[model samples]
Target: MTLALVTDDMTTGVLKTTDGERKSRTKLYWKRRREALSAVALERLADLGIEFPVVAGTMTIPEVCDYFSISRSTLTNIARQYYEELIEAGYMPGSVTQPTRYSELALAHVAMILRPSTSDQAMIIQKALGIYRAPRGAVKVHNQSGAHVKVCGRVLDEAYKLVSEIREDDPEEVWKALEKRNRHELQVLTVALAALVPNDRGGLRAWLAEIGLGIHSDAQNKAAVGLASLVPSRQQVSE
Candidate 1:
């Protein structure tokens, strides 16, 4: 009687493990189709918010098998089931394959949800993956030959300092406080402009003369009308 009971226990154990064994083989069946997954399909996975490389589309079988941890011949047999669809999706690229992407219908048919690619998708993915870069310095300088333009940063700080000595926003008020002979705002603007380019006095004089600034052009800082060498090219970048 004891021998009979041991035989029954062995039979029960095999029955219980059979389901898990079949499931393992099923997973392996799908995993071996290496050529099935394509770059575009991977992008599609990102779009779909699918976890990892796993996807259900005709072209996504390799990914699905991978997710299931299936390998070897079992993966090959499962892959054969979607073999035709994979070829149609251009996964099996050959001589005549003109490099095509998977179709929407095919992608949707398989279980992968296809999401639209947005302009911010790249940033979103980076954020999702916890990737970031440190911010850069804010100071910017633009050179247009001798017309050196220091944008924002130090320029704004200096402008505000000069302006605070007189009025906040009104150039006329600033001039009045300084007691200039000519109340013209342009004259004041030119003087204020001079402060920006302490390094390029010649360029300042040339620019001032053209606008009838009437400020004596320093013989020591002469600049040609056709030449403004201190100014930076628009294409050049400085931080």
Candidate 2:
């Protein structure tokens, strides 16, 4: 065997570094290559209908490879090399043992660009937006107002009490006494209260609306027109 083939200059089996270097072995300057797809590679991915978003809970890297007829190693190389750009492009991280999922935006873009069926396209967009269909029979709502309605017993009892208490034959005296207490302000308040039907019983308001005499009875609203008419109009006062 030749002497050069068997020997290292340092005698430690490594060639000594030159130019006043301290190392007995030569240093390696790593050649860094950006881990991004070239234009051709990107075009290929697009042609394969692969989108770029990292939709959560969607397919894994292996699944993606399967769908696109690609190998895992190729995808892994892209990920390992161009991780930053991938993230900026909305790639997401994988959890536990799963591979990364594409984002909603990515899924939707792929679906759109691939010209899938209308329903499938909608589904893809929904998936990308993280929207899910409500499961059948998840919600059952009942109309409570239509059921179990009895005439208000308390209101009836109160009315009975009011009737029993009003034994006086002269209601004018009572009316005068009430008006004197608040000087007609009480009448205004009572009118306002009467105009507003707070109970959702669909009784008075519903009936009025059905009869073409809704609470907003006229163009200015029935309540305003009616209330205003109760006071003499400007034309009437001028006359």
Candidate 3:
């Protein structure tokens, strides 16, 4: 019985059976790609001594715009996208009783979202925030009996603590926070290999073959070729 692993491209899907064994590397490839990208971004942040701000109390629209150097429209757009999140984080919204003002934490989050970084690093920050700072049970999982279960708020407790405790003068602590959040995507050696020979399909295939993750079909080879583009080049940067 062939198990059809669901992916955007069925032919190049994950966990498909090939030659009497389960072998597909799409997930691994993306995981490594994320790690490599995150590492580079994290190093840059450390070098720049970029400290995520800890502005306390609430701030009105003009104050936020001035401090962050962002447009009012940009803040409105991001606030709308994270409206529910802002409320849950104790940031007050404009109402009959009170004016809308954002918590310092909310402002910090907005800065994180807007920080200049590569796509993968952005994704990592978003996911980490969702998992650690989001409202209770942001993610759900299926149990052994296929019953949907809410993940505990404390699931990423360590990473959450690390992020919350990052110090201004301690760049190493900043690195640790991001690295902790990116724990699941950790695959340093694999990412190093991908970087060393990004264009060498034959070499990649050989290396993967030795490790039992080789492209086993024409469809997968095509998929692998396309996936190679996901690996960031030396010059990949935000516009």
Candidate 4:
């Protein structure tokens, strides 16, 4: 009687294991069906050539993958295969190291891929171009109490325009023209013009001249004297 019971228990366990396998197979089938649908959607998007977008004024490979929820390997393969197809026909810039570093050629490539409107393309190009730098400096004045005061800030945009105009002409010519102006007049003009020009030693000199101040001639002379003094002292050492 005990042996008969043991055999019955073994048969029941085997039946349960068979049922579990059937359920697992059904789940796998549904999972595969969903993956197939997702793959179809991705392919449809690829057919429409909707992979790339402008990022930081450049077209990047990773940005496209992230936007589409696609694997890197799959995207890379797709890019390699359809790269010329997209370029020759679709007008996309393909991919680069970073979107921010997109060159003019790259922008042209993107234009083909995206088929942007002429105006839209122009805007994108504008955004990608380098921005102009603004000028900045410190202002100093002596108060009635004989205290020296200084204020530092960016020059006004209008002042920058004047500086830009001045740069278009010769620097020495601009200085010689301003030489006859009084200190107060020079100060106002120099500060206004400096705001527009690129920062450099020449620009600094131009700025000083605009303000009725010349380059530190006394400092240069003093340095020359000091060097001459050192030469005699050095000769004494050698003797």
lDDT of the structure predicted as candidate 1 = 0.39
> Model 4: residues >4 Å from true position, as ranges?
1-53, 56-58, 89-239
Q: Number of the top candidate by lDDT?
A: 3
lDDT of each: 0.39, 0.42, 0.48, 0.41
lDDT of 4 by residue, 173-219 (tens): 65555566789656755665654444423544433344333323445
- Specify the highest-TM-score model's number: 3
* Better-scoring candidate (TM-score), 1 or 2: 2
Tell me which residue pairs clash in candidate 3.
Answer: none
* Better lDDT candidate (1, 4): 4
Tell me the lDDT of candidate 2.
Answer: 0.42
Clash numbers, per candidate = 17, 10, 0, 13
Instruction: Give residue 202's error in model 4 in angstroms.
Output: 59
Better by lDDT, candidate 3 or 1:
3
The TM-score ranking, best first, is: 3, 2, 4, 1
Provide the lDDT at 20 for model 1.
Answer: 57
Off by over 4 Å in 3: 1-56, 117-239
